[model samples]
Target: MSLALPLQRTEVLVIGAGPAGSAAARQLARAGFDVLLVDQQPQGRDKICGDGLIPDAHKALARLGLLEQVMALAQPVSHVGCIAPRGGRIDVPGELAVLPRRELDNLLCQAAQDAGARFLAPARFEKPLVNEQGRVCGAQVRIGDDVHEIACDWLLLATGAVPKALIAAEMCERHTPSGVALRGYVHAPSMVGRIKAMEVVWNKAVRPGYGWIFPAPNDCFNIGVGVTDSHKAVSGKGSKKELNLRAIFDAFCANYEPAAALMREGKLLGELKGAPLRCTLDGARWSRPGLLVTGEAAGSTYSFTGEGIGKAMETGMLAADAIIQGKAKQWNDAQLREAYEQSLRALKPKFDLYQRANRVNAAPWLADLLIWRAKRSPRLLARMSGVLRETSNPGNLVSLKGFSRLFLE
Candidate 1:
């Protein structure tokens, strides 16, 4: 039976109830805005991701006042173990945590509810609704078999990488700077001794990408592989032209010693699944009048590590801040635009640093050399660690000046 919903109105309509939407909704609601958060899933669902929370993620959660809740559910990790193509390993010290997205997303949504945001689950976004002036004023959504319209003063899209809604709304022609990534869980309690931290492995075949084994709560490990869209295009001809990320992941487990060791004893928890990783901070629109795009939908993932959760949440909060600031002064759309763009500018330095890391990954030899250098250079290792923590930029490690200071000096 089609259950029709009544006409709904909200000060802010946040589409997608992931970290980005939930965070934005929580902030805006707490600040006295009537926020409506929606998602297609009836209950919080698991997503294909490493699910590791580095220091920056911690900061974003803390800002949303849900850090303590997340920390309680996460498995603590203190270091990152990086493996070069030739089997050389380097461990960088930092605080890290991993929690399944199923749990994390639910907790974030509950937090948003507690802060006064109304939630509409199992509601799928159809498209953006624009005013006569071509300004987006709200969204069209479908719940079950009934379609409904949600009118809002502002619309925030936290839809994450794919850009289906973005394209439907005429926000972009298509997604640019995208990559394919695969992830799955494995139950390996006995292998915990060898896997004490997040492990990242690089192989010659998976240039411009890498494989990861992140320890999760319980005896599970999130294992995955990723490769950029550009890398896949130039990979080869014929059937080889299409890059099989799963095959790449399987080959990585077979070749990488640490990963191989775990797979031997660990049982697969579920089927491995893959998705498009929307990265590289380019060619995505952030705002169009009453609407704003935050999170991966706005290209917030760091190209260097393919880490999106933290940046995603950060962009959400930034959008909320801009909205709150504009509301205070009753600013016009032009003013809101300025505030939002100003907020996005804060990420430029970090994004630039990630771009540099992308270049390093393109040249495997240089990245491997840097990994080797980190094994012997404490200063370099510390700086590398700081990049993950958001205290240092990745560019500092690969820049000519930084290279000279570390190796030549």
Candidate 2:
């Protein structure tokens, strides 16, 4: 079949209409740039995710004028319950929120549209359009049977982890690490009448990651297991080499006492869905002349909490700023590269610290010890929780004097 080629033009083109793409498109359009947002799936489509939004996400939503819509669609979670391998529990009190990705993404896309961004939903990005000088000019896309070539001075890639088009264009490298996420929806029968807390169950059997049960509204819950690729790589001793997140979940529900109780009262409501988790923080081929990358496509997803929505939004906002400034001043590659690098530099330290902390938690014994300590000391738990939640930096949690007082006093 001959591919029909249609032509269009815009000032800025955003690929992928997820949180990051929509956020950037909205910000850019608000700044008076003729922005076009494109996505493979139609509007109101669902993306697989943990569906839990932290406080930082709330702040981002507010900035995007999405807080009201999000609040209306989401349920507020007030606590996090941690369960250890030995059946020990640590309940940390905090404000958390949950919403399905379908609702959240739709809300964000709508906000972008409201801000004057044109959306091309159900459109697949075919490839990047390159000029004779080898610089990216824009993108070639397909909406159903019609192919369209959209030209822009700036191209922003917010295409999530599986950036197939970007990889195909040879604009970015792909690393198929063994990390996997097995997630499903479950009916929380036991917690139906009670205020539910987001839960994490840690065990050595589920090495390099923990199992989670996050509360959703309407008596439903999102439960999953995130296993590291390192664990999968090491487990290749036999036929059972691949990490079976479903098997892990079933085993936990069947064998682990607390988990068993929770499952016995709950109903498995959906099939287990799996997705690849990129573990590396290596940036994508971000810029070549007029193009840039944002969100997971640029490895902006935090290796620590696997949280990318907030970081994606933050980076998207910054990218919009850089693009606006770049366009106004006829900025060269050096200026744009400097701006992108500066943004990453400012954000990387916190992400690096979080990754280190995640490495610590991935160790079953270390996680057990930390939970034990947290259970024994509420103050320590609060400080640690603050660090994990990214509400405060780890350095500010305690000083030498405070550490001395924890034991010395």
What lDDT does each candidate get? 0.82, 0.73
lDDT score for candidate 2 against the true structure: 0.73
Clashing pairs in 1: none
lDDT (Cα, tens digit) per residue for candidate 2, span 332-366: 86797679768877887777665655653366665
Which parts of model 1 have CA positions greater than 4 angstroms off? 1-4, 229-241
lDDT at position 406, candidate 1? 72
> RMSD in Å for candidate 1, one decimal?
3.1
The pairs that clash in candidate 2 are none
| Ten contiguous residues minimizing lDDT sum, candidate 1 | 231-240
Report the error of model 2 at residue 306, Å. Answer: 2.0
Q: Candidate 1, residues 1-409: lDDT per residue as tens digits?
A: 1233658888999999888899999999999999999988865777778898988899999999888889999999999988888877888888789998899988988899999998888888999888999888889998879788989999998887776788877765344436668888889998887798798887776666788999998988988887754433222110123577877887888888767877888998879888766665554677889988888788787776788888888989999999999989989998997889788887877887887877665676766788888888888888888888888878877778877877852
